[model samples]
Target: MDNDEPLESKTTEETETQPAPQSSDEMLYCEAEVPTPVDKEKAGRENSETDLEIEDTEKLFTTGQKELYTEACKLMGVVPVSCFLRNMEESYMNLNHHGLGPHGTKAIAIALVSNTTVISLEVADNCIMEEGTLSLVEMLQENYYLQELNISDNALGLEGAKIISEFLQRNSSSLFNLQLSGNNFKDDSAELLCQALSANYRIKEIDLSHNQFSDKGGELLGHMLALNVGLLSLDLSWNHLCSQAAMALSNGLKANITLKTLDLSMNGFGNEGAAALAEVLRLNSCLASLDISSNDISTEGVSKISKGLEFNESLKVLKLFLNPISIDGATLLILSIKKNPKSKMENLDISNVMVSEQFVKTLDGVYAVHPQLDVVYKSIQGLSVKKTILQWTNPMKLIQSYADQKEITILDFFKSLSATGAMKMSAGEFWKAMTKQNQVPLNRSQLRELTKRLEDSTGMVDFSVLSVAKP
Candidate 1:
């Protein structure tokens, strides 16, 4: 004790002079230095930075977005919905079949005014009228992020179309695809739209199908097509376009430089229209796909169209099916395609068109020049092309038998597959239903070929067509 303790021991007098021993906490407090002005400022700044980081990381909608949504809800007399706000974060917002009336549509449009994320907006079958359309037009003026807009099957009449056309004339640079199909647009609306489209150079695709656009409207669109340089695809199918209208559109093709696809199906593009298209095809080489199916194009029309095929080297897909083309006309078509050594044609759909044995032989010879060319036909005379057609008739017959045994019409049979009671069902779903449980004895490729015949451009099979179809 004397050796170890004497070296470190302090005198009693010195310890008393220093002060009483203190605890660790008391020592720390006595020795701690007070923060200076600079130190306090540094700590404040760090706390502020942390708050900002949390705010940015936790916030889902920006201030502008929140303001827009609040305003929309106020105008609609509804409370703000969290789900709707969540959709603001998505790139695509589909509100199809939501029964969003004029007010609802206008509200949604307002909410989208400040959106920076949404690029594709689908508001189809929403009962949108002039008011709703005007709101959208205004929103589009401020919102440039949206590039694709689908407002199909709305009641946007002439006034609505006029509003849209005006907006397009001024602000169409942001849009690449526009769908206005199934609207009640007439000739006047068509004229207005055509004028706007002529001025626009950014839109790549436009759908004006299933409207009331007649010859007068068609003629205006034709002139627009001639002037437009940015449009790559145009759909005028299921409209009231007639022979003169077809001729006008064909003339438009002569001057078009960017258009690659043109759909004039289910119109009355008769022989005169065919002749005009034929002449245009010979001159223009930009178009790659042309659909004139069910356009009332007859033997003479096919004959005239064949002449165009003789010289065409850019057309890859030609759909002349469902037309009243005769064996002689089809034979002439095959001959024209054969003569064109520079032809780049890949698909020739002459379905529902019967051909003679001689035409089949000639078609076989055409394959020598274009071995990759695929021809879709109904049947051949005195010979079977089952290998080529994938046994189209056999599948149809099997479907017909199933429908008969079920004691339901063919249309009903297809309709049964649709869960929504709609007149249409998906091609893939229909294929699965037909092939499921050995209902339709066919492989995947065979079913696909048959389904292609039954499906429309949307890849949906229309059961209504089955009512009048010949088994």
Candidate 2:
């Protein structure tokens, strides 16, 4: 959409003999590069201190911005509709510690508080540390009109996160999107952020990626993920989430149906974690895009993820870039896709996979069968043949079956399976089956705990006493 190619010419080209369907030859095909938008007015406008209650006007404006005092005076009470405080020169992710200083942030905060029409605020990459964040929260508390907030890439440490989290709890802020990515947030800080995320129902998209989170963030992730149905996308890439953390998120995601895009790339979630997430995919049908690239996963993890693909119908984009999935892993993924009649995946990225030349030839054959789908890999050849794509299955029809069974009845049925004079079974099998049957009124964690308790190696006795009642 950002391309400058004329629509008329594109239409005319399409009207002409339609080009034969082509498959992707390169790993990165048709990757559209969007040129960054440059606002001449904002770029040229001198950064002078806008009219605010704060004193010291002389030191407020930088020497180069001294002349813009007249313009600043005119734009007094009603600042503007959208505020662009982002440093255009710096890359989005490159922001380390460059942002509006405390003084500048404070001044802007004071002015923005009174401005009722100001909807969106973008103050990213300005090293607005704790002091600036405190000042911003002051605005967030009073001004409910502000909808979008971007204070990303600032080295706002633990104190900053605490302030923001505490402020969010007190006030009903109207923010729909929050960008706090690469803020050097610690585990404790991320824990604080989870509260804000769960409370803010208006929030739809959030970026907490590259925060180096640990158990602190993972502990409350299930509750956080479960609370936000409005959220569409979440970025937690490069957060160093271990198997425990990954499992926590997977359990949370078991009931989530709104989140569409998730980026968990570079986290060290091994096969165990990936397998747990696969179980999540069996129940969730809303997530459309998923990225678990560069997580040091092996064929086992890949196989588990492929199994998830077999059950997931909404997923369209999968990124497995720079992982240790070899030819065997690739085969598992391919076979899984082939098995799933309801898989909606159209784009798959498998760059840097360890595969044989024969496997590459196999992909060529797959391309010949499914030319429309973009299957990107290191060694791929374009070909045109019969249309092939994963078709929808009867899963949507069976969705009601998951909920239709009465929880109490299912609990009793499982109890009967291991009851007096019935088939002698392990306590773990009975508990596992009971949990599977009792999906309602119980979160994934609760079910898992029951199953785990039953799995105790000491040959656990009676699970009939376990309560699966609605809380």
Candidate 3:
């Protein structure tokens, strides 16, 4: 959760031809993955779990369910990522309870078997079980085309994990970007995958977060990683990987040369574990990004990591958020980064590091001097929907937040609405009034829903929703 891929836009043209992979050993790394819960999206939008809308030009057939799969393949070739094949504006593929039994997996399997152009696929959150995954495995066994496969949030249980791991050990699958996050990959089954990982370097990027990978699983991962040569990015966050696992992974990094990004956030890697990992940063030159955020790393660990940074030449992003690294620790770390003239650091996230206001102000001055080294040192907290609405609805508050010089007030806002000379109005009327001559964030129906929420009895304006003070 520290950093993520760029957001996808639906308006972007889908017909734009995507260049095919150069290597016969097609790489499977891309920006699409398992689906996560988003806001109920815009109010105007219908239920966001509808089927994908294929373009007229991309349709190859219009038969039964088979055509849907064929059309999916036709549209998918436009982008390397199958997830991006979706129209960003439309509702996403949300098949929680409706896994379609065996038919859903067969549809995708048929598409994969027939199409050789498609590379990346994101079929996560479908609650797919052994049958669906086994169906995919069967197709992938003969497939040299599939590079990326995201089957996260499915029911790929212990047996399934063992099955996939054993399959990978045979070098039959060519998947490069494989994400198995949120599947119950427990210790014994996880170890099977780790054993396979020792020999299989075909996978370049993998996400095994939010599973049951603990210190015991970490030991297996560490032993394999020491000999791993092809893996560039690894995400092991939120798996309860404690200090012992951190130390083991750190030991693996000492001899690792291919790993560039490692996310150890949301784990329990304390200072003792971080101190062990610090040595790799000192010796390894290939690592480009490291996320130790949400760990209880204090000054002692920061001091050691800073020493490693002195010798690091390729490290870029260092996320140390949610730690106990107070002002003194941050100051020492910042000074160490300054000493590394060869450091290609683009951003450092030290947010919620228990720093004082004065220390943050000083860090801001440093950030101003070295704009390339952007420092994020803020606390991230959640807000209620009602509170968010109240603040956003206030015209003066919104204008001030945007830093616009146009002096608009609550009175002016009401007067502008009154220009139409109607005290009571429908959401449709309010939508037109609010979106006059400019693009508002809300859709047409969203504007109407907001009007409904704020209007009082007899459809009179609440006025209170728009009464927040400008910052």
Top candidate on lDDT is 1
Candidate 2, position 341, lDDT: 66
lDDT by residue (tens digit), candidate 1, 1-471? 111111011421122212232343322111122124312321122232231111233232544565465444333433333334557789988777655666556667767765789999998887878767877877787678999999999978898889889888885449889999999999989989999999898789899899999999888998998999889999989999898898888888899999998888998988998999999889998998899999888898899999999999788778988899888888888789899998877678888987767777788788666754667777666665556465445666777898788777777766666567568765535644654445546643466566777888665776777778776
Off by over 4 Å in 1: 1-71, 78-87, 381-471
RMSD of each: 22.4, 19.7, 17.9
Q: Which portions of model 3 show Cα errors greater than 4 Å? A: 1-98, 354-371, 379-471
Over the full model, what C-alpha lDDT does candidate 1 score relative to the true structure? 0.73
Candidate 3 clash pair list: none
Question: Would you list the rank order by lDDT, best first?
Answer: 1, 3, 2
Candidate 1: lDDT of 410?
A: 71
Better of 2 and 3 by TM-score: 3
TM-scores for candidates 1 onward, in order: 0.68, 0.59, 0.61
Ranking by TM-score: 1, 3, 2
Model 1 lowest lDDT segment of ten? 1-10
lDDT per residue as tens, model 2, 1-471 = 112111221422221222222332211111111122211112111232222333344533431221122123212211111112222112231222222355445545655554556676777777677766877777676668778788887878898889878876664677777888888887778778787777765678888887878755775766689876678889999786878888889877876778988999988888887887788777788887889888778888988888888888877778888888877888777667666766666567887765566776665554334332345565423422232112222331232354355543433443564536233345434433444443333322243344454444343434444345442
